[model samples]
Target: MNIKKIMHVENLTHFYGNQIGCKGINFDLYKGEILGIVGESGSGKSTLLKCLSGEISPSAGKINISLDQGGVKDFLSLPEQEKRQLMRSMWGIVHQNPRDGLNLRISAGGNIAERLLNVSEKNYSFLRNTGKYWMEKTEMDSDRIDEFPLSFSGGMQQRLQISKILSSNPQIVFMDEPTGGLDVSVQAKILDTIKSIVRDINVTMIIVTHDLAVVRFLTDKLLVMKDGIVVETGLTDRVLDDPQHSYTQLLTSSILQV
Candidate 1:
């Protein structure tokens, strides 16, 4: 079977003032494939993610993404309103910090319901039941549905964010350091939950993380970036186990040494 390319990014480059964010990046994400972008800090992983997700516009590039309805679109060239609609409808983003993705003032269920609402879901019973279902899927306690996310543990809050993002049934998700800033145990649980959920859904994902273990665990393809460019790209196992690029080798060695 021919793989369907859901997203194609070519010559994607961005700059923070004069500093390069990402330069000459090109990649294609297939339907239901999880792609990982791994690099050290300031290597432009986050910058490239933001550009792809449309949180920030790049200096120049082409981001051709297939919409849920039909046909591919250059999201960067779309009108602001259309872009905003696309983000809410067909795409989801999981931020490194849970606070960046969740509305602290809202109840846990409310947060999930918000995404459903954005997609024009108005039936209260369906929304409520879907919210509970997602909470359960993320390994979160369904009893805490009415509680505020701020009252939940850090790990639980992250799970809530995941539930919210998945509630809308997004075709694609962009995750930046999904397991970052948590203890070893917490990170392991979160990674397991993410891996399990992605396996059960037909969602394509592009995740940016410095964690080699995360790439190995959750991604099918991997890109190793250095100084704003992708230095290596291949099967996750091949690239991680036998990296060809010097930068990729150095990165793997440094992680192993730690």
Candidate 2:
């Protein structure tokens, strides 16, 4: 059984003037698959995620996405308007900071409704109901649908952000440190909710994090990066259990010591 390939990235490189952001990155993301990019700070994992999610343009490389409309298109080649349309309809991004992804002044349900609106959902009743449904689905209380995001706890805000993104039923979701800065217990619950939602929705996801435990618990495949390069790429268990690269070995060993 050949799994459908949802994205193909080749020789992806980015530069910040004289500095390298990420270099020669390559990977294929398949439908319903979860891939993690892990590295320490300044490893360029975040830069790579930004490039992949269209937050920034790569200095060079090809990112081809299999479109639902029935063909592959170079994501980097699309017009700005088209890129925005694709992002609005088919791709979702969850930022490390929930505030970055959400509108703090809006009601939780309104935040979700805004995404639905972008996808051309016009019925007010359906939008409200969908928001309520997604809130519950993400383990958030539906009763707080009318509350502003600022009133929610950090964990709840993150869950609300997830609800807003997933409410549109996007084909791909890019998460940058989804559990970052939260309490360990909060992170655990969010991770569990994320895992369950991904499985339930069968949506493809690419996550960037420094936590090996996050990859171990949530990712099917992993990429270990150092100095803007992918030093190792393999199944999560294989890479963690028996890392071949020195950097990867160091990463795995550090996790073991903790």
Candidate 3:
């Protein structure tokens, strides 16, 4: 059985006034695969994720989506309410800044349960138990889950963000540098936690990061970009070891050799 493409984009183009965002963007994310996007700072990796996650709309082209519910829909053209429903339950996004994405004053449990409340809130014990379970799944202490987000370390907060998003059980995950600016050891541990958790649930993920090490560890397919256009895309091992494009070779070389 062929896994229908969960997400699809064709000839996607965007603009901020006269500035080009990305043109001719095309890709398909299959079920249960980690698709990694890597590019320089201004290369539109973040922009593309935003588009896919419905945070922003593209200026042109179509985003066709096949929901698990047996409904086929076009993303770029949807009623605002329908879009909201899709985003709230079907798509999980972890922005680059953990602080920007989460409510800092809310207890970590509240943050995770926020989306869970969307379905049904009649059972309080079950909600709390689910939240507590994910905190442990993220390797976070259950005792600290009731603490405010501001009280946790940066890495811990990122895990909270993941837990919050995952609690909703989105079919597609859009993660922007979920493990950046942390100490190497912490980054490794966080990646390990993410890898384990996402795999166990068989979730589809698209992570945009400049870190090649992250790409190697978290993804099977690699998409490389520069100046808002994809230069190369292939299996992770091939793209990293024997890149076909100059930009991809440069990116592969930039990684710290083991």
Candidate 4:
């Protein structure tokens, strides 16, 4: 089956003053595909994700997105309001820290409804029902709809964050270390929920993480970054099994050997 291309990035580059964040990065993401960017600290994987998601502007390059409503459009060239509308309507971003992505003061259901509100969903009963639905999908107890995220565990908070984002039915999601701060058991459950939800919804995603096991489990395609450049890119299994780059070999070996 042939998949439609959703995003095309060409010669994307970003810098922080004199320091390189990412340079000459280019890739294509297709519908319903999960692409992983994996590297150690300071490797620019996160930076690349930010540039792609339009959280930050790149120093140079073009980012074109194929919208379901119409033709391809330049992501960076869009006005701030258009970009904001695009994010609220068609895209979602999940931050590494739950606090960063979530509003701790609001009830879990409120958090989910917030996304709906952003897209101008108004019916109060409908919003409540949708929130309850997503909570159940994320394995969260709907009865706790009124409970604030501040009282939840790290894992639950992350689950709430996922539920909130997915509730919007976004075409593409950008995640930064989705399972970064959690116990192994908790992380496993969260990951399973994420995988199931994405599969059910057929949402495309770009996930940035340092965990090889994470990328191996969640992504079909992989990008390995080092020193602010993509050192290798290939099918996840192929790259892990027979890495073409020395850095990639070291990464896979170091993780598996641990």
Each model's TM-score?
0.97, 0.98, 0.96, 0.98
Instruction: Give residue 108's error in model 1 in angstroms.
Output: 0.4
Candidate 2 local lDDT, residue 167: 92
Write the residue-wise lDDT of candidate 4 on 1-258 in tens digits: 888999999999999999999999989999999999999999999889888887899999999999998789999999889888877768989999989989888899899998999988999999999999999999989999999999898898998998899999999999999999899999899999999988898999999999988998899999999999999999999999999999998998897553
Candidates' C-alpha lDDT: 0.92, 0.94, 0.87, 0.92
Encode model 3's per-residue lDDT on 1-258: one tens digit a residue: 887688788988888888878878888879998999999999998888877877898888889998988687898888888888877777878877899779887899998888788766658898899899989999999998789999898899888998988988889888999888777888999999999998799999999999998999999899999998899989999999899998888877776666
lDDT of 2 by residue, 90-174 (tens): 8999999999999988999999999999978899999999999999999998999999999999999999999999999999999
> lDDT at 155 for candidate 2?
97
User: Which pairs of residues have clashing backbones in candidate 3?
Assistant: none
Candidate 4 worst ten-residue window by lDDT? 249-258
In model 2, which runs have C-alpha deviations exceeding 4 angstroms?
256-258
TM-score head-to-head 1 vs 2, winner: 2
List where candidate 1 sits over 4 angstroms from the true fold.
none
